[model samples]
Target: MNLPKRNSEDGRYYLMTPDAREKLQPLFDRCIRDAIDGKITRPDSLYPPVVVSSEGAPFGVHYLAMDWAEAQRAETFNVEQAVAFSENLRRLSRWGEIDHYLLGVLERELQKKYFVVTGREDDHRWNREYSLKPGIRAEDVPEPLLRFACYVAVSYKVYGLDFQYLDTNYLLGLVEKVRPNMVKKLKENGTGRLPLNLQKRKKEHFTASANDAFAVIRISAKDCTEECYSEVLNYLCELLSQEDFPRSYAVEFKGPEKKYLSITGLPKKGINQLCACAVQYPSLQSLLERYARLAMRQYERYTNLDDEQCALPGSFAVFALGMLGQPWRQLVWDYLGLCDDEHSRLQEKFLREYVKQFGFTADTVPIFVRGVLSMQSMKYSKDYAAWMANAESLGALLDAKARLSEIVPSGFSSDDDDEDDEPTDETEAGPEEVLQYAWETVCYVIWGKASAKRGLKVVETAPEELKERYRQIFE
Candidate 1:
């Protein structure tokens, strides 16, 4: 945490009815339209919410992270708009006259790619010399952040109430507009990565882009006063910081003055008695994870969790509005009560829903099964193997799949078919052969079709062999 509050690493938000959204949309549009119509649009257009706050709500209710006005302006920003904004700032700064180098620096700053540097683990994000409230253990937030974050946030509470927020959604539209150009420049810049220099006091393994930007500003704006160049650089740094993309954003709830949700800590998972702030709010925290995970998979090149753990996180990325999280997954969180070991209970509630939502696809079912097994449970792990060993028909019989009936000698049914209570032998294959082929097809997909085909003949005939072999995948 810097001495003067830096806006980028910190964030803000609002929660209002659909009605409030309508009022805010037009005011934002009004600002842009006015700008195009020759009135200057400043970043502070939405400042002092009374100027632009939605009617019938608390004044100054607008989320203040990027400032509501800045956020609104970004929505319709084009690459051309980004250029104009930079040029406009330059003209106002009189920087070209002061230093031609700064003209280039300012231009280059516009085209920047930022990365997050999550420092130490085990630091509390928020505490009042706060003892760890008994909850699930989580990665720690840095102590400096916890103590200093109040100056960072809290005062801007919408209606004096803390509003939940998104990580990148609060991002400036201008940043998104310049993204393509930023990538090109990043390549031209040839690795912004510097050799490891240990930051001693903070214990942070890495430094933020804000720090990097300030250094550049000091050198580039040597002619300007400390106040002038520093202020400009700080503002620019805040914008660049927004581009940083939070490493691991989370949600925390505590009813207090600066103590409840430790605004000071790194915005990772929940800390202290929060029970690992990651899971409590499915709608919110998971969305942040999905966003961060997506950034890693598509934009960045680092990862903390293993490939197997990436199952859920990797599902949907690079899909804008059209993407959705796996609904069955959200259900799994709800089903996990105090402990995670209730595999049978969860399978009934969780996996059963999955089968319903997704009919037996050879690949997804196997992959999904593995993701479920990733849940940390000795019982789930041990019991899953035993369950599969005893299971007949790859557990298809346990699904919403058509049931076996004496009336229809064709014992199997399309699990995909909802209306058909029992399967008819539509294809030439017999019921036993159909189930066998289904199981084999599933096995083939998991081990990859190119391999694992040779064992099919022996396994198909021997139930015990098939069960043990299937159980091995879990092991």
Candidate 2:
């Protein structure tokens, strides 16, 4: 199938149905009509916010106001925070017990200073009815505040923080005390009148963003003991270790040693940047579902073409993994059993298909290397290309190749090889060369050179022979 056209304005490639707007137009119209007619007491939270276009027909749809805040936050904590967090943890020797005190301190820091963690109050989608109204309306409630409230409530309930701060009745009572005229004015307006700023709007498609709330742990000026510090650090790590998705956020600690500790959900910033440039990522749950729909469609198309092979090309799956990144990468890998040793059937099948597709012989190592090198000549920016060509990455590829050789025989040559075939020098080098070339390309395409360096570092420390081989490659 042909690739989608690049959006001239943003240079993004998008796939949309031919009549997507026409199909959605009536639905948008009905939502506004019902809300105005009071047929529906509130707008449906399920639908994206709808505003009438000044030009008519094509009404503009802004994101779910809440998503704006999330995108902003996701782009904030970043990799530097995670690095700092990790470095600080390395300094502690004597760890203490993680009790209520540490959890309470972190909870208070997160909840009490909500404005700092989340954005300003004005940052939320402002609906007079939802923000000022006396009763609960799911659609009317600003998403950030609701989410914050949920976080605070959950922290108090689960972690046993002072629940008084989040008590619904106490909150309402404060509102009554402070803004007595608010509800009266809302009542006078009858059907909720939107603010002037929200009258007319424009809409854009959703891109997944990393809107995560991070916890920053800091030591007070008091002469903090090492035991107390270790206790706090351990507790934070424990909290960070819970689950992958919703619970996955950055954790930063500022200790007396002047070092910082951080743990974030995604990989480093450089890797994410490279992946972002190469492929569309699905950071948001909604976007993931949309991408899954597209993948399923592709799967069906390939299934019709051939049933003997795996559902998709393993190379294509590798490309998808790079695009997905982080938590999504692990999630996709788990779904495909890419990391499962017990399910080696798929991996072995992929290897056979790979050998056949490329027609690789034991003597074709140089050809494979050249193929990968030629691909690097594409019109990526000079900086991007430089990242892929760096020495550290070459070493990493060498290490990856060496390690993979242990699992798949180093003598693997072609799909037709028999058990009786002798392991010649050429055969021994073939599989390693294939892995080196493929992984080098994958790393270059997905994560650029920095991640490749990190990958080599893993092989350097984790295995003795690979480390020596890695040193030799770079030597």
Candidate 3:
């Protein structure tokens, strides 16, 4: 049928050609007869009728003609017009079955408008209420809804109202129709096959046996005195023998005897920079620093001795077995070896301290306890020796200051605000300046060394009694 060309200029009306009108006549007649027979009804019967543009609108033949003309001239048929038509048909006794015929017509019209049909008429009602944006195409329906449709099709062997005509090809056809477009979109967005490598790595890292030892050694001039290398070797041996550590990993003393003990298994990869030890530890940088210092001191001390006596290697492996499968609570309990009563007390004390420090209540105490245990594990690892040293220095400095405050009595001074006040000048300092000050202060107290002598004048002024007390504590 030759349909009238849409008017490009105004975009409102399209004249119905003779051929197109003839083609549409049968559908229109069927709808009209159905309406007159009370086979159709308005979906929303409570809504008020729309006001006619012209005065004294007629019913029956005249009304139908007016509506036909309006539909032809208008950009689209509005909700009010659709509802009025349905209601008029119902009143005329055109519809036989309210649920079957009326709902079927609505569904047909929605499909023609390119809506992906949902299994729910309730959803349709909600969409109308919310005035949801029209879907431009079938796939514009949400992914969850599409998946739900697929699931229903698979489980019930049904396709919409044609549920009785079960066919395997119907479900296969749906999948075939949607798959290509979905895959194309995924590829275009660079998401297809994106996570494969990450997933594989995680699987391998979690499943592999722990035969490799990850070691961090520190060397310094001070550690070389009094057979310090022998002592370090002894410590390494003890660490390897611990029941919790991987039995397959071993460390050798190699001192004077040039002998080595064989562990049950060893990883194919040798000790190298690229080898990733699966063990999680805190303050790795500090640990490495301490190892380097100790190593250097050993080298300096045993310079006169044979190479075998001075060179000491240590390693410890972490096992992957049950690592991922174990609950965090069980892991903590096993690691700490806490007795039943001690565990309860630990949980209570941890909860109280955590709430006070972090200012949040938790639903479970286990999560906070796990976090504390994790932190402790990291701190005690060989990797965190440097961090421990620095932390120790800071702790000592604070302790000294606290002792000084305790020993010295406050003098009767005019500056009452001094008791609680901070140095106001620091507020003006940039982040870099603040960071530099912190770093220097930490180094000075911990390592008894400072990179720069500058900024010492910024120290807060105290009363003569306080100053004397601080000096006495240091001395």
Candidate 4:
């Protein structure tokens, strides 16, 4: 089987076979569409830079895959940090207890050869990745070694590179699915009234972030001795012995006689850059849950517990894993399983954030959502090609925007508004600007350029609510 080989000239990697792209692009296309429609539990779990897009995409929908060139550099472990952590342990004579798997990883590092280790306890996605360093030719590696890499690379591809993307075409469709409850949420937030649910989510986000940041083990600097270091190492080993830990965790040693030791794990963000993986992706959540629990037991040992007393719960279910936005994901799956539905209901919280950003009046919000959705989901490929290529399509779009402006109100007054402060002609004119923003966003989302210029008219803008353009899919 042909695999990706490094180009001797430019010093970059390329997938060898053309047929592979042909075979796998369609599969990713299906998965991406399903994910956006709320079918997939962990939309963020799909490996290989899976993205959302529309129109020019290969599959007849808004989902596509794009090659992630930056992934290799980002995925490379921090060698300096890893080495210092190891050397400190060895100096303290705690290296013998370093487990076999980590030892292998360390050995490969010392030899100056490349080794990519998959994080343990994965979920719906095959997130295992590889790095083909500069100066390493394809011929140097065995065919069997890269076959799986080739398969995964192909499975989520669109065309040559663009393995995954941010498909804004369907965002309109997604926005159209919002419930009335969500509309009320938008108005509530506009009035500076925080919902109970958001208050809870805010607390959860804070706690999860604080805990992950505080994942450091501390011992007094005065107690600095080989025995103290070994004691800490033994605690870590015992913590790791339990299944409760992120599969990608590593222990980083601090300076000589330092008061603390940090167990650095994979950045909770994982492959989906915007959201943290510990709260969204199942496998990572399971591992972090394990890590947190294991570390807790170790902490208990430092105070009152003995070795046997510090054992973890044998069968802890990682429903929420103590991270923000995870329990709702579990509920989504429970909903799907019990109802046997193809897609879970649109998340009210998600829509709440949506309208919170746009601030559409309850009356006009649905209309605005429908207009954008129609523009995105509309299948006029020949027309879209013309639009991207020239000015007529954009002109028509702007005209449509003008027409939509007349009908759609920009915003609504809260109950606190005085009778004298009620909307007037100037207030009615607000939809013109709002709809102008909407169409500009539509142009940007569809075109992907910083600005869409046609003749002298130019539309340049950004997206909110979906700006990270990256979102987590609920299970």
Candidate 5:
């Protein structure tokens, strides 16, 4: 559909309705007054471009990106150069002696081109391309002059100003005074208007459903010292007391301390669990994800960066997969109260469907299965030799299973422990070990000690051949 074009004479978005014309007349007069005072001699000075489009009318303004020629001319030292320089200075974060030199250049140019009289009044109306004028051809106007006009047009479009007649000298002075202070004012007030043509797309991915909300909780040692198991457990207890969740969640660690930090709650319980989770998992992956999303949003808001350089992490897909495979899986089981038989059947079904969807080789299946098992077994700390051998063995087993059409048995289930089962060792595992085990399992359903007094759960269904291969490497 062809959208109505904005009029270039006034900064509004529609063709000149009678009411709009009435509003614009005074602004045009003012612009002419300013132009005369600033000694702008061209007849075009009395007919400055409009900044908006009226119904059935053409757009009032347009923009070109800052070019090299414009940038160079903005640096000149003369009256006109000074005006252009001052305008640029107003936009810069930091301007110094060089900026002052250019401002002087613009002032001189304005005096030469314009006729400055204290109270002379001039008025006219013309229709042409918003940026062009009869006597003031594009070739005759320096790049700095064009750039300055463009900036004025842009400001008018954003702020709804009448530019047909402006006090150019007064504006020049205002630019000079505010140039150094613009940054401070922006930080303090944040009142600048955005360009009128800018359109923001509504966020489409987020759902208002409570289940869609996720929280990341972070836990840390009260002091920066190494965390103890007791302290971590105490913190977790305290957090649980503060937050109620409809479902379980996952946590992760960040930084060298490995002190428990952040927790991410599933959708239903996010609001209730977030703060407490933060207390337990200080370096929570959910917190990281939130920050990452924010950074990505900021990057998208500004079109200055390329896809590769955007703040979104490269490992996001892998991290998401881990979340789905492990903690999310556990949450489903716990929430649905799946029995051992049901859980095993579901796992087999899932594997078969996944293999079919991906057209994966049988050899690839064992390797993938082993990786999943290792993730579930909390064996990430195993040495390189052990990891490699386990992988190779798993690959071979997957091949055998594929060829035989054998369904692998369920490996480890977290709910299998008997109430009477107890650990033989009395000494508590180090805080690092406890936290690491907890964190990994939360990421990938790895089996580990449920508590200091509980023994570890070994994954049962990953296959004997793969287990033997891992043992040989470790031994």
Candidate 6:
């Protein structure tokens, strides 16, 4: 069979066809599925270990299709395995974008001995010879490609690492290196408005402004050549023109091999003018107020849209009200009417937490009760039902103007109530442990009033009428 057969009409992922699926079904069912599925439970920030069934598993080649988005590979493939490798290189140079790092790792593990192109652009005899690896089944492709593709499918879970944390001492050292050069330049070309004179105003100004100044300086460093002193001066002048930069600027002088010669400082009246401008307008408070209003409107738009599959809108609404302290009571009420499905229930639970946190009393009990109870059609676990029962009672107290502080049992909110005293032993508990915990904590709050109204434990399984109501909504 051809390697990397296009199984789906629209897919970025490598496909496993029905024939290939059946051929590999025993291996998947007996060995791979449980192991990989367990690994999938880990947080998205980590990459799961790659899996290969056997040591002698064949290598599969995947060619870039013309219809696919032009891939920008971060690295190149050096073909040291086959004569066809040279042609493969010629073809890939026109088609494939390779990640050299990932490819290098894969190459070592796979130990490339043949080069095969999955698709046809040439009918050369050498192409057919490498199309299928010897001793491999007609239904099977190479094991390495399959493993790589599976990893690619779930790679979206990886979180972007923050790279913006720069050490203060390291930054100041750069400033120390650059300051002396600026002073020398100042003597050669002094001006009242230049940053060369600004350093004399305050020593703290240099340290205070180094971070912003470094951002500009780093760009100049990268662009600086063997003889770019004039470029450095231009960068310093540009920093002076920006309102955000402080009173001082520094430049690092370069010696003959582009070695560091010295650092010089320049001072100007930039900070004084900045202070004068601050007095003319109190824009920070005004701008913050304006931004808050804009954020609220944007959140409103997010809540109203149904295009996204996730319950992000409900979370956004809760976050807006909880974190930003938005006074959008009507928006929260409107959000209640919109949440009617299993997926939205999670967001509704988050909203309930925000509602209770902000001390929404009996006046808001009806909203919580109706919103949470409306998801009865969803396949929420029995534990979730139990949580809903307890939550309903709290809402009932709010409805009857009862004091929650008096009703909540003593020690329930105490630190000793934590259940995470024991370390988690299972590496692959699936996501159920998290879901059950969410239901018990957040969802339990919203169902409190509904529990009292029905005279049933919130944790009890849903009654038939509730299920029917859910069906009716969908119908």
Query: Could you say which candidate leads in lDDT?
Result: 6
lDDT of 3 at 146: 30
In terms of TM-score, how similar is model 3 to the real structure? 0.16
Candidate 5, run of 10 with poorest lDDT:
296-305
Work out the TM-score per prediction.
0.22, 0.23, 0.16, 0.16, 0.21, 0.23
Clashes of each: 7, 7, 32, 24, 83, 35
lDDT of 4 by residue, 33-132 (tens): 4433433221111111112223212221111212211111213554333333322222111122222223233224311254333356463122433344
The CA root-mean-square deviation of candidate 1, after full C-alpha superposition on the true structure, stands at 24.5
lDDT value for candidate 6?
0.30
lDDT, candidates in the order shown: 0.27, 0.29, 0.28, 0.28, 0.28, 0.30
Give candidate 6 regions above 4 Å deviation.
1-15, 18-286, 289-358, 361-455, 458-475
Candidate 3, 168-255: lDDT as tens digits: 2332233334444642432232123223332112121121112111111121212222233333433333333433322212121212
Give the root-mean-square deviation of each candidate in angstroms: 24.5, 23.3, 29.7, 26.0, 25.5, 21.5
Indicate the TM-score of model 1. 0.22
Q: After superposition, which runs of candidate 2 have C-alpha atoms over 4 Å from their true positions?
A: 1-216, 221-226, 241-255, 259-399, 402-475
Please state the error at residue 396 of candidate 2 in Å: 8.2
Candidate 1 per-residue lDDT over residues 97-169, each given as its tens digit = 2222322222222212121213354642221122222341222322222211121121111101123112111
lDDT per residue as tens, model 2, 58-149: 22122211122233232132333322221121111000111222223223432233322234566522211123334533343333333333
Query: How would you encode candidate 6's per-residue C-alpha lDDT over 188-244 as one tens digit per residue?
Result: 433223354332321211212122322212222322232233333233444545454
Error of 5 at 336 (Å): 30
Model 4: worst 10 consecutive residues (lDDT sum): 204-213
